[model samples]
Target: MAMITWITDDGRHRQAEVNDGSNLMLAATFEDVPGIDGDCGGCLSCATCHVVVDAAWAERVGGPGDHETVLLDTTASPRQPHSRLSCQIISRPELDGLVLHVPAEAW
Candidate 1:
């Protein structure tokens, strides 16, 4: 399992041990991480699970896909250089300790 950290806009940090191959949006909801509302349930249809990968871990996490890129633009938070949809990010051993900043709003 990979240890993922989600930092809220107000500076709250929530960590969870996510199984390999599991998308972050599902894991975040299971762990009760605030600010991640997975409204579309990882269907890549909603932007509620938007997150800004920590700069230090952005490269390892890589970039979003074509459809996901467009969805990022609709996120409640303005897209950042490292912005990504949590549902598009899968957990893996290489991603241990990954950090994702959760915006205050997930509309």
Candidate 2:
């Protein structure tokens, strides 16, 4: 399992052990992490799972794809340089200790 840490906009933090191959949205939802609505489930249709990869893990996590980028533009929060759609981030052993910052709102 990979240890994923989620940091909320208000500075709250929660960590969960997520199985490898699971996407970030699934991990967060499974653990009931606050600030991640994931309104559209894992579909790429919505930006409710928007998050910003921590700067320390940005390169390792990479950025969003073209389609995801389009959806991110519609997020309730302003998109940042490290913005990403959690549904699009597939977890792996290599991302064992990934850290993500949840926006204040995702809709």
Q: How high is the CA lDDT of each candidate model?
A: 0.93, 0.88
Q: What is the lDDT of residue 93 in candidate 1?
A: 99
Q: Could you give candidate 1's per-residue lDDT for residues 1-107 as a string of tens digits?
A: 99999999999999999999999999999988888889889999999999999999999999999999989889987899999999999999999999999987877
For model 2, residues 16-105, the per-residue Cα lDDT tens digits are 988878899988888888878788888899788989998999999988888998988899999999999998899888888999999888
**Against the hidden true structure, what lDDT does model 1 obtain?**
0.93
lDDT of candidate 2 vs native? 0.88
Clashes in candidate 1: how many?
0
TM-score of each: 0.97, 0.95
In TM-score terms, candidate 1 sits at 0.97
Model 1 spans > 4 angstroms off: none
